[model samples]
Target: SQTIHQWPATLVQPVGSPLSLECTVEGTSNPNLYWYRQAAGRGLQLLFYSVGIGQISSEVPQNLSASRPQDRQFILSSKKLLLSDSGFYLCAWTNRETIYEQYFGPGTRLTVT
Candidate 1:
């Protein structure tokens, strides 16, 4: 069975501070990884996606960046968080052969003060 894990279920940070969030998957290999942000009462917006190590596709250009250094590890980082960066961050994975569905782990809600 495949499972995903993300840390720091909730975060509060001052505006202009740095941010780092991590996500990892188990029981799968070479899965397509994606980072999505959802504001309160809104749908998810894709931030970044990785098809392989060092290969990331950015869906939006903003105050966020993503990296995949290993097969199952994906990281989201920001140099200086903005007030607009406050939202729920989610990490998801989908099997390369199956694009119809994506599995999301527990998300991290971030508040930029």
Candidate 2:
């Protein structure tokens, strides 16, 4: 079975600190990876996505970036965090065969002060 993992399940940082969040998948190959941010009581916002290694698509212009250095690894980073960046960050994966069925990681809660 495939599984997705996200680290730093919870985080607290100042407004200008750098941020790095990692996500990895197991038991899947060539899966489309996605990054989403959900504000309290708000719907998830697609931040970034990758179809293949070294290919990243930004859904919105923000203070964040994503990279896929390996087949199953996706990283989200921010050079300087903002108060508005505080939210629940989730990583998900899906393959072409099961594109409708996206598997999500446990997610990380970020609090920017």
Candidate 3:
């Protein structure tokens, strides 16, 4: 079975600090990776996506950035955190063969104070 993992399941930080979140997948190759954020009581917003190594697409206008450092590994990072950046961050994966299907990790809830 395939699995996706996200680390530091929860985080709380003050304004203006750096942030780094990691996501990785097992049992799959060349999978499409995606980063999403959901505000409290709001729908999910697609932040960034990678179809392959070094191939990333931003879905919206946001300060967040995503990178595929290696196959099966995607990283989301920010040089400085913003209060509005606080949200539930999720990492999801899907393959070209199963474009309609996606698997998501438990997610990381971030709070900026």
Candidate 4:
């Protein structure tokens, strides 16, 4: 069975600080990883996607970036943050052999003040 995990379930930061959020997937190989964000009362927005290591696609253009250091690990980072960048960040993965069914992590809720 595969599982996805995210850290810092909740975060509070002042504007202009750096940010790093991580996600890891277990029990799968060569899966397609994704990063998403959902603002309060809004639909999920795709931020980034990785088909493999060193191959990342960005769906949203912001002050954020993602990296896949290992087969099962994905990291999201920001050099400097803004108040408008606050939201619930989620990580997900879909197995290529599983008909593209995605499984998501618990998520990281961030608030910038």
Candidate 5:
């Protein structure tokens, strides 16, 4: 059984401040990981994805960055957050054999003040 975990279910950060969010998966190995952002009443937008360690694909060029240092640990970071960065951040993982279905963890809702 694979499961994912994300921290700081809700966050409030001042504009231009730094941001760091973490996500980890258990019971899986070398799964494809993804970071998505969803605004209020909007669909999700892919931020980044990783096929393996140190191999990341950025879907959008924004103020955020992602890193996969370990097999099951993924991190999202930003040097300077912007007001537009406020949104729901989600972490998802899917087995390579089953790429069509992805499991998402509880998202982190960020509000830039």
Candidate 6:
């Protein structure tokens, strides 16, 4: 069985601080990984995605970036946090076998101030 994991279930950061969020999957290989953010009462917005190691695709131009250093590891980082960065950050994964179904992690709630 495949499982996804996200760290720091909740975070509070001051504006202009650096941010790093990690996500990893177990029992999956070469899976497509995704990073998404959902503001209060808003839909999920795709931030970044990776199809393979070191291959990243950004969906929107923002203050964040993502990297896939390993087959099952994905990291999201920001050089400087913004007030608008406060939101629920989610990590998800899907493989060819389950391309239509995405498995999500518990998520990290970031509060920027």
lDDT score of residue 21 within candidate 2: 99
lDDT per residue as tens, model 4, 7-105: 989999889999999999999999999999999999999999999998899998999999999999999999889999899999999998885588999
Question: Model 5: per-residue lDDT, tens digit, 1-109?
Answer: 9999998899999998999999999999999999999999999999999999999999999889999999998999999999999999999999999998999999999
The TM-score of candidate 3 is: 0.97
Candidate 1: global Cα-lDDT?
A: 0.96
What is candidate 3's local distance difference test score? 0.93
Q: Stretches of candidate 2 above 4 Å error?
A: none
lDDT to native, each model: 0.96, 0.97, 0.93, 0.94, 0.95, 0.96
Q: Give each model a TM-score.
A: 0.98, 0.98, 0.97, 0.97, 0.98, 0.98
- For residues 1-113, what per-residue lDDT tens digits would candidate 6 score against the true structure? 88999998999999999999999999989999999999999999999989999999999999899999999999999999999999999999999677999989999999999
Q: Report model 2's TM-score to 2 decimal places.
A: 0.98
lDDT of 6: 0.96
Model 1 superposed RMSD (Cα): 0.6
TM-score of 4: 0.97
Clashes of each: 0, 0, 0, 0, 0, 0
- Candidate 1 per-residue C-alpha lDDT over 1-113 given as tens digits, one digit per residue, 9 for 90 to 100: 99999988999999999999999999999999999999999999999999999999999989799999999999999999999999999999999999898999899999999
lDDT by residue (17-111, candidate 3, tens digit) is: 98999999999999999999999999989999999999999988767788998989999989889999999999999988999999999899999
| Whole-model alpha-carbon lDDT for candidate 2 | 0.97
Q: Rate residue 73 of model 3 by lDDT.
A: 95
